[model samples]
Target: MQAVRGVLAVFVLALVGIVSGGKMISDFPKLSVQQMCELMPADTSFLRPHTCNYWVRCPANNTSLEEGTCAAGLNYNKDLGRCTMAANVDCPYSKDSISTTDNLCANETDGTFLADNSSNDCKGYILCKARRENKSNCPNNLIFNPTTRSCVYTNQYRCPVNGAKTKSPACLSLPNNTRLANDEHCEKYYICVDDILYERECSDQSAYDVVLGRCVSALNATCYSTAKLPPPENTFCTSMGKPKVGYFADDESCSHYYICGDTVNGKHDTNPQHLQCGQGLYFDYEKLSCRERLNVRCTLDRCADTSLTYVNVLGDCQAYARCSGGATVGSGRCPADYYFDERSQGCTPVNHNYVACAA
Candidate 1:
């Protein structure tokens, strides 16, 4: 009877264990089919009968497979899982779209072509279709020159010059419309166009004033090596021989322009005009001048670079803290009667006197 009882008791315990195990399994949430596929091995390759093999670029070191698609100017190749030029695709060809020739790109029209797909983690090449046939791995410092049909150095290059014994200074190529000073001649400067340098002489034989960055009579020329300066309205002592009255802008509010009045005891009296946009209003640069602060577009990354004073929604020039890498760095504020200059990134007193803006 005891043996019979023991067997019955074991059977009852086993039944209880089975029932609890089933409940635990049902309690766990199940993943969907898509999730299951994604969780599979990364470098997975499979085949469909009579079709191309499918592959996920799950290299051992890669954490995830890259998105599969060709760039806008390229066509995808299903067999190799790569992208090629529009003309290289094996699909239906459009005769009008491209002109194919075996002349090694010499007869090809002027354009740019990519040799391989860049969307994936694979190397690629850029080909130039120019009068002279050439191929290159256009690195960061080099760009393809269509005119020459070759890759040329960007920052450094040898300008073509006629035969002369005295070599010319290594001409620094600049963008079009950019002006640069000519160290050799004070009455002339240089401008760049089409990666070619052109010398420009000041009209009337005037000297190029470095401070003003323009041509002026030699007698009136005052060169400044740096661009940082007080307001353009402020007359340089060397130019006027004395301080003069005019409105100048500091690093602060535009509505609050500064005025430099007659010199007092050989010192210019710089004072603020104390212009007001309202109690909560701050000045804003609408275009070149200041108005009430408005909702101007700004990126968070740039706005956080340094401490700044900006017009809030309520129009007050409130202090903002500096940030580094999206983290706060420090905080600061301008003194009374002074505003922060966004250009110079410094606090400037409103103009009421002629003390130097730096002072």
Candidate 2:
């Protein structure tokens, strides 16, 4: 009866310790090799099986058990009663199950890793478990600028002029030299200068037209000028190249012609030289002299077949005809104070007073 009572008392103590989640022995003595190793069965998790590196019977006389921790890089299998390699210890879940060089959690199989929406914090790997992105967010109404590498508001940023807008909600650069018409005035226009739009008024009571690039009179506006013509070799010169002599009107008066001579000492003579046809007479190349502009008969010649020439009539140098392809197609004109001479086969000054047919 005494032995049974002692056994019953020991069992009752063990049962109480197990049920109350209390350690029966406050401090267990360290175990050495060749000693009994034991593990408390109640202390193990049901999901993850507990392992014991070394176990021992408390006091070396009781049946109650105690467990010791596993060694580094080793895990204990309670069923096998021996320490094993950690790689061989298979857990039910793969979370926190791997090691690596750049990141210890690189091989961790916690959750989905979103590479496109991830932050720089996980530089080499990811450990997010919620399936949402772990992105570093910018402040309210601000966007990340990759060039500046900072968050900036759209309104505060000064984008480049005439550049395409960026993807990160930044301000767009407007095109340079854009023009707009003013609503209040016909003569006034708007021009974008250096990305700033401002009103520009045309001088001299002219209406604005973008195609004409200037203002003109609403009724008597004449936007036509020889200045609008492009110069030779893309240069804005008075004259250049072969066929040494050419003519341009001196202003809107059409009373004088600016003789554009070829390169003399490597420079063009753009200034108009004085030449006059006396009153009651107009220059006529057909007669090769100053004759009346009206009732003038120009005799056609075979020399005109291969060359082009012009004789002035009705007061304009540009008003002329093509002398080519075996026929004089239409009436020709000369410069303001000059006329074509069939004898010379070129333009001559009327002030020379030399007649093609002289006595």
- Each model's total of backbone clashes: 16, 9
Put down candidate 2 lDDT per residue, 1-359, tens digits, no spaces.
77446544543343333221211111111113112122111222111111223332232333344546667887554334455787885432234322101122234454433221122211111223332212223434443343543344555344333343111100001123434333324465545344233446676445665334456665543222211211223222343453335544333222223455566776555443544344423345334354532333322332232343543323332334445563556765567777555434466665323332221
Model 2 per-residue lDDT at 186: 47
The regions of model 2 sitting more than 4 angstroms off are 1-178, 181-190, 193-195, 198-275, 279-354
TM-score of each: 0.16, 0.16
Minimum summed lDDT over a 10-residue window in model 1 is located at: 166-175
Question: Model 1: what TM-score?
Answer: 0.16
Per residue, candidate 1 scores C-alpha lDDT tens digits across 151-265 of: 3454333434334221111111111333444433456554434323345777643766653456787567543232122223333322256565555433443234444566777
Q: Residue 81 in candidate 2 has what lDDT?
A: 44
Alpha-carbon deviation at 282 in model 2, angstroms? 8.3
The superposed Cα distance between candidate 1 and the true structure at residue 276, in angstroms, equals 72
Clashes of 1: 16
